[model samples]
Target chain A: MSKKVVVIYSGGMDSFTVLHKAMQQGLTPYALTFDYGQRHIKEIEVAREVCEELGVHHKVIDISAINQLIGGSSLTDSSIDVAQGHYQQESMKSTVVPNRNMILLSLAIGYAVSLGAEQVYYGAHSGDHEIYPDCRPIFVEKMNDVAAVANYEKVEIFSPYLNNNKSGILKDGLAMGLDYSKTWTCYNGREKACGKCGSCVERLEAFAANGLKDPIAYEDT
Target chain B: MSKKVVVIYSGGMDSFTVLHKAMQQGLTPYALTFDYGQRHIKEIEVAREVCEELGVHHKVIDISAINQLIGGSSLTDSSIDVAQGHYQQESMKSTVVPNRNMILLSLAIGYAVSLGAEQVYYGAHSGDHEIYPDCRPIFVEKMNDVAAVANYEKVEIFSPYLNNNKSGILKDGLAMGLDYSKTWTCYNGREKACGKCGSCVERLEAFAANGLKDPIAYEDT
Candidate 1:
């Protein structure tokens, strides 16, 4: 029997890869996307398309209240501009939504436990650990302990890319025959991705390092 | 200068006491209420009344989607009957919403971080430790560790009644000269509370043990 797992699908490349990887491992995946009023609301549409193509159950939870509850993050606040350059740049810190992963993972665990699923998956890579505190190894371990006590089922959290970078995730996605065109990673949320933003730059670099062209169109690419 | 604290107000006797306790400590309190699909949804209105009387800011978050995600809980599922008798009875286990406190506290932390609140308060008493795992001290410690890593501001979660029972909580509230008449604690939402349900039974016992009459009217009282 295939193990049931809930995938935190954000319609981003990393999450796209996580979904495909879970499928490759013979796990029944439930894609959970949070509509948290992000600048890139278009990612939710892309998530729907990805789930449809993969024949998986998709759940889009409305947590838009988070945008009102948390302010400072460029992703949710229009006053702060999305920075261009690499993920390691100091300005990229504005894009960090405090406790974003913690809140998402907490809800995902509740959904997973309700469904009797044993595992919850998210694509928190080593790259995110630099800017996003909740993406770090210690956060994952501590959150898992919280999950253990929070539910009777003891659902475990799985982050396959925790030790890997975006490039490694891209390589794995390519091996799983995932079509990267369906994914969206631009922070600017334009008709065509503003390929100069930190998210776009990192994604473009990962594709370039893999000796392949990114499938999505970009304003600058 | 008083430190601001966000109190998780459910309009129950316990949470009502928590709000009064925070006020007695001279802390600025913000009440957060979750409008989850609960049988006792009328408690939300009671929460609003309590907040208005206390003159504290109240935030009502819509999280009814949890009812769709988690179905086994009698509190959220209409098909399941609200079990009657003592809270420690085996049938009362059905009232447990998996990870209820964790999900609520996660959002409360986000709200606290947004407002620069240094502490978040909830009324999880020792009486709840038996049926609710999330109410235990170990869970509280682990969740605080997660909160520390999850946010840059590091909002601490405080449970004033963590070591006390329902009777103790009532005693403290009485000492504070709080008007318990506004609080609501009924598993079955109706014109008058069904006094036979586990929640009503426990609450009545607490008031009786404290030599005080519960202010709210009950069908069988």
Candidate 2:
């Protein structure tokens, strides 16, 4: 029997790659997605479709009840417009969801414990460290400490891409012959990806850095 | 304006006392309760009543969606019986919800960050150190480290009763003239508390240590 890992699959390029990487490592991956009332809820649908195609056990937890409690972010609050231009722009700070990674990881640890899985994987790459504090290596390390003793069964938080850039992650996924179209990166929830948003721009840059055109459709391009 | 604090109010004796402690400290208290599909869901209702009577801002977050992901504990799984006898007994280990405090504290920290509150409080005490790993001081300290960096707004995890036993907590509540009947601690979800259960037995012991009769009615009493 293969070891089981709980992957935090957000239907984004990073997590989509993370999920596939878990499978490639011979670990049975259980995808855990959270619907935290984000503006880009389209990612949840994308995640569900990919999970179905891969025959993976997936759970899209609806934590929208917490919307009222964790609002004020462009990702969750309708009033705040999603930031455009480079992902490292100061305006991108508005995209930060308060304590989001910690909350998601905590719940994932609980699920892993319930399933007797020893590891929980999330995609927190180096690029996010500039804008999101929770994505920094230190934050993940501290959370790892809590996860170690949080339950009777110790669960390790495995962020394999913590030091990798988005381009590096994309390069690895391409090497695995993984299709990126199944993932969504645009912060704006629209029929076509808004290439202007910080997320979409960063994703496009990553694909360009890999000397390849992104398979997903873009409204601005 | 007084500073604000988010209290993880479970409608148990410990949290009920913690909620009042926040008010007594002259800080505005926002009560946060989670409906995690526990067998003793009656406690949620009791929490609501106490918050309503106190005119405190309260939210009952329904996270029952994760019930399937976090089953196997007697608290959340119907297949398991509520453990009887002293809470320190080995059988009481079944009552441990996997990583329960980390999940709860994470959400509380998110809510606190959203409200611009600097502090998040819970009712973890020394009595639970024997059976629950998440209730220990080390777990709370590590969670606090994550909470501080999880968001741009620094939030603190404050477990004021971490070193105190249940009797000490009860003494504090009694000194504040708190009404004990408003909080529910029975493991069984019956109309009357099953006095033989670990939680009830512990509560009874706390009252006895205080040399006072408990105000709540029990099945075996």
Candidate 3:
């Protein structure tokens, strides 16, 4: 039997790649997505479709109740506009969702413990380290320390792309022949991806770095 | 204006005490409760009542969505029987919710960050150290480390009862003239508290150690 792992699938390019990478490594991946009242809720639908196509055990947890508590971020709060332009720009700081990664990771660890899985995979790449403090190496290291003793059954946080940039992750996913079109990277939940948002711009840059055109439709393309 | 703190109020003796303690310290307390599909869900109602009486800002976050992901514990799983006897006993391990504190603390930290509050208080005590891994000192220490860096706002995990037993916590509440009847600590969520269950037994013991009777009615009283 293959080792089971919980993959924090956000329907974003990074997590879509992480899901495939987990399968490629012979680990049975259980996809866990969170609906945290993000502006780009379309990603949840995208995640559901991809999980269905892959026949993966997937759960889209509706944590929208926390929206009242963890607001002020452009991602979860409608009042704040999503940042545009470069992903590493100072304006991108508005996109930080408080302690989002910790909350998601904690829930994932609980799920992994319930399933008796000893590992959880999340796509916290190097590019996220610039604006999101929770995506930094130190945050993951401290979170790992918490996860190790948080339960009777110790769960390890496995972020294979922690040191890798988005381009590197995309390159690996392309090597696996993964479908990037299935993922959503726009901060706006429109019919077509908004190419102006920080997330979409970064994703486009990643695809460009890989010397390939993104398969997804973009409003500004 | 007084400083603000997010209190993980569970409507148990420990948290109820912590809520008052926060107020006593001249800190504005925002009570945060989680509805995690525990068998003793009456505690949530009790928590609501206490928060109302205190005129404190309260939020009952419905995280029951994760119940599907974390369902092995007797607290949340109906298939498992509530463990009886002392909380320190081996059988009481059945009451351990997988990574429960980490999940609660993470959400509390998020809420704190959102409110610009730098502190989060939870009711983990020395009595819980035996059966629950998440209640241990190391667990709080590591979780604190994660909380410190999880967000740009830097929320702190403040477990005042980490080294204090239930009796000590009870003593503090007694000194504050807190009404114990408002709190619920039963594992079973029947009409009355099941006095034989680990939580009830421990709570009763705490009251006894404080040389006072618990105001709440119990089934076996």
| Candidate of highest lDDT | 2
Error of 1 at B59 (Å): 0.9
**Top-scoring candidate (DockQ):** 3
Q: Order the candidates by DockQ, highest first — what do you get?
A: 3, 2, 1
True contacts kept of each: 0.65, 0.84, 0.92
Predicted candidate 2 versus true structure: per-residue lDDT over A1-97, tens digit per residue:
8999999999999999999999999999999999888876899999999999999999988888778788888988999888789988899998888
lDDT of each: 0.88, 0.91, 0.90
Candidate 3 C-alpha lDDT tens digits along A1-221: 89999999999999999999999999999999998888767899999999999999999888888887888888877888888899878998988887899989999999999898999999999999989999999999999998998888999999999999999999989999998989998889999988999888899899999999999998856
Candidate 3 Cα errors over 4 Å, as ranges = none
In model 1, state the lDDT of residue B186: 88
Model 3, docking class: high
Residues forming the 10-long window of minimal summed lDDT in candidate 1 chain B: B62-71
Give each model's clash number.
0, 0, 0
As for candidate 3, its clashing pairs are: none
